[model samples]
Target: MNQELISHDGPGHRWLAERQVAGVKLGLERVKNLLKRMGDPQDTPAVAIVAGTNGKGSTSAMLAALCDEAGLQVGHFTSPHLVETRERYRVNGRCISAEQLDAALVHVRDCAGSDLAVTPFEVMAAAAYWLFRDLDLAVMEVGLGGRLDATNVTDPIVAVITQIARDHTRVLGDTLAAIAQEKVAVARQGRPVVMAHPTVTLAALRRIGLTCPVRKVGKDVQVQDVRIGGAGLGTQAVLRGRALSEPLQIELSLPGRHQLNNAAAAVLAYQEICAAWPKAWPDAVEVVWRLAEVPWPARLEVIETSPMMIVDGAHNTAGMRALAETMAERGKRWQVVLSVRDNRDPEPLIRELSAVSEGFWLPRMQADRMWDPHKLAEVIDLCAPHADVAVGSAQGCFEEARRQAHRSCGVVVTGSLYGIGEWLGRGEIVSPRLRRWLDGQAPQDQ
Candidate 1:
């Protein structure tokens, strides 16, 4: 097995990997049952469930960061982590320790009993809930469609939908409307639902039987003067919403103009939760826009500066479009190291990458269900017929792309977050402790 794709070498991490064969079972029964056995820990925290095709992670991370800045005990649970599986859960901006994760898994296993079958995601969600039982708030990102996702078990104080697009069609649904319906299901009646996706409308949400008060971007909350400050400078915008008495200016550390909405949505959700439970969040708790310091891995993350190598997790067409736009605004075509999951449609991705790509290197990703590099090259041929493209191993592709990009252009390592993890495992930018853990050293020994 490719060591990069295998989360970590710890026994608990390995056990979680073993459950991956079951794939994604989209239902609430298993996860709900698992949490129930654990004494329903999800009920304690003021939960904010974020669901969308793209920008969900950025939104969730920003919300947690905002909460943390406000001196609130916050837990953040996101998915498809860039560095480690433990990155999926965080308390006060730090990832849950390897030992704590293992211990929590053990406790969950005991609670689950022998007969109850649970997926790794379900187990992780249950474990996160138990770990976060004492937290003032928990920002949970939905793994799949909102309706049946494991995180949906929590009744959130506020729900956020960030830029819903047509990805995950097989399970969520093929049409945009269908996907929107699936995502909006996370919101409960009488609670507030923050909608950041421009494509989804209030009428459509109501048609889908939504009774929740919808706080939408450009409507309930308004963002103006969105400025992309190159790669490192992040995006800047002036946001106005019901929660704020005056217009608030924000400069998100996460790049792209698309992040403006995500940031606005995060701020609004933070405000909504604070309003719902004012005692939990005192009146003195200020809305701190310390977003420029928030570090979300693999989302336009710059790992190398010599040739300006940027690693982004632009897995879908919508995300690719956003990435391509950012690269265009920077005025430099990139030497692209790209790979895609097997389930993704390679055409749109290839087309978007091609526009911003000086050349393309299709690498063999270390994750499961990846598109064969050579076969993917064939799709690239059709998408950008005049473009320069090649296929090779992950290391070789990155090295060659780096070499070519040294002339004047930069290198963009994208297509999937797992691809970023593969690079991290190879010592591109992984932390020393994580490096040892990836090298099969137990946390105690490290």
Candidate 2:
């Protein structure tokens, strides 16, 4: 857990904060046991587990929205929240109140007595499941790789893998195939696993020992005539898939051509769900058109217009590549304010980013394992010798970058979602819960 995340003043918050000492234990035993004690709320609702390196969050959000449009009360769980911890749990696109989260945490703590050891993420997952016990369906974005991920305890009706790439190398191995193996394990024998990335083929999945049916993007679901929208707009495409009755015209509110793959995966996953429940199916055209209304934050999220300021959660190489590709298509160079987690290999991210960047501003982030600004600057110099670089506090770097971009190109804050959260907290785009946290107050204390 990050230092800032643990600083909240509340009983439930304190309980979760103390579990940070146990750190990230990536196994399912403790979580499964903890949820069992809570009466296994995870088993009550229909589940769709989304696993991938880059686009899982967007894919999960899109799947939830599609389900919502079909008249299902949907619960969504995502990790490493951008602004508020409560953002991790949502029902029908609305975040649960702090009281709801805290009450659930209290129940989780009582269920997880002294004997049952659990990590922070496990506790959160348990709470989300318990809170969502009555919901019609739930969409969970895997916090890490899927096989042993805590979220894998549920038997998903459908599994979604979107754009697997080299990430978490220290834990998931150093190759894309090795990473895909871990992600694909979320699938079961009878269910369908939607594979959206071009690199992860049915052959690769077969080699990795997959028994479940694989529905690939280009084959099972096709996205054609992809038009990357201009500045301040999103991509539009025609979705054609075996799961759909006919080809549907789709417009994504989230920018970047990369999202087309994610959208396809969501559609396939929803179709798989409908196959099982039959009654869950809605008017295909009406619900498919709702893709344009999905509200996922921080992926090319624009915070301002004049001298446009955008914040993206492009921390890894694949994510940075997508961001770069989007910028290249728009033919716009940006002044970037960036910081990444220390565990990542920053060279590839810098190389991809520098290609579409005018300059770089390395900001200090108030989270654990964030890269040192000076160290990041050294890599930036090696990666793009022509681009100017600055290193300082978050406020200093953001102000300087804003000023420089105002004179020339637009400004982008990216490289880490935590860094974007800090920037969002300081700017006008803040949730009330996050504003309270930034001000060091409990929600009720304010």
Candidate 3:
């Protein structure tokens, strides 16, 4: 490793940050070249590539937990970190340390050869491969559409797609079928492709002519006895599939009906790879129960009680609608603190929030991609002419929302993960577990 790049606060992070200027090039040549220079670290023995519009991160986390429970060393790579950049890489349920991240980035930077133009995400993907080169299995979440995503360079044993919806339409396409085709492009020939999306997307995949075998959730695997836990608890369901002789009961720490599909998809992917392991692994039931302990942050996560406040990273229209439906199912009115990335179309998200929230608070995130608060307020007013809207810093908006909310009402902080990270960084929300996890410390019991 380069001595200058090893300092956490020094040139290491700056080197990575400077590459942000290239910003989201949807191609594989740069990443492929970087990996080749790094001795093709992604050529691992076992790998699973997960792609979808919404639930891919949760599915990756669930799959990592199941593999860990079965006594396997697991490495997970996901995107858009909540608090720290190291959160994007994890091994055996723990975030990568700053030292480890800096070391890995040094290798990635050196391997890029000083001439190849690489994006920030591609660099991170390369570093993850270098950091976890010796792990037993790797679970990688596609940062964007799957076809040319930086994480797609690896030859995956199984490609999993969870709940395809309308997102990144400019690059992928405007139609659902077009998006589905891009998502399933990660599927390899003669390998199993696991999916948990609707029939429309399934039909779209078929229309695109999928050559690999597909194991669908509702068709190939059965999800029965679905139940949501009470009072902010997670969800429970039964999973039945060809991989198991009998139905497996599952309990998950992640909430929402959508998460059930993610869990089922993870289980199906696990089944596809279980036969390749050398030792006797845990039973399906045991793996399902162990999934309940996976701590995936900022997805309908509750941080406080009394004037209850929850933070979720729901940016797209479909994700916002799902959050609204989940709130409605609880029979509680909520106050919303919203911020969005500059690239997103905010009209639909604002309309969804207006339907579920009694009022809106518009906060400016510290990140460069955040939308302006003044323009966001105008959109909120246009969508919800009768609703009260406030604009300020995230901390000020959160404070005002808490003061205005009734004791029985819930408060939701959402729109972008960057906003949620800002909220957590300000120490306004007291979640020791999340704090510990971000700081590279083991989480304590709640």
How accurate locally is residue 9 in candidate 3, as Cα lDDT from 0 to 100? 72
Error of 1 at 196 (Å): 0.5
Off by over 4 Å in 1: 1-11, 198-201, 230-233, 241-243, 280-286, 428-446
RMSD (Å) of each candidate, 1 decimal: 4.0, 3.9, 3.2
Candidate 3 residue runs with Cα over 4 Å from true position: 1-7, 207-209, 241-243, 430-433, 439-446
Q: Which candidate do you rate higher for lDDT, 1 or 2? A: 2
User: What is the descending lDDT order?
Assistant: 2, 3, 1
Candidate 2 structure lDDT: 0.81
Tens-digit lDDT track of model 2 for 74-157:
999998876557778888877777677878888999999998879989999999899899998989999998888889998899
Ranked by TM-score, top first: 3, 2, 1
Candidate that would win on lDDT: 2
The all-Cα superposition gives candidate 1 an RMSD in Å to the true structure of 4.0
lDDT of each: 0.78, 0.81, 0.80
Write candidate 3's Cα lDDT for 266-358 as tens digits.
Answer: 988887778556667777676677777778788887777667777789999888988887777655457888888888988999888777677
Q: Write candidate 1's Cα lDDT for 93-120 as tens digits.
A: 7777777787787788788777778887
Candidate 1: Cα lDDT at 123: 80
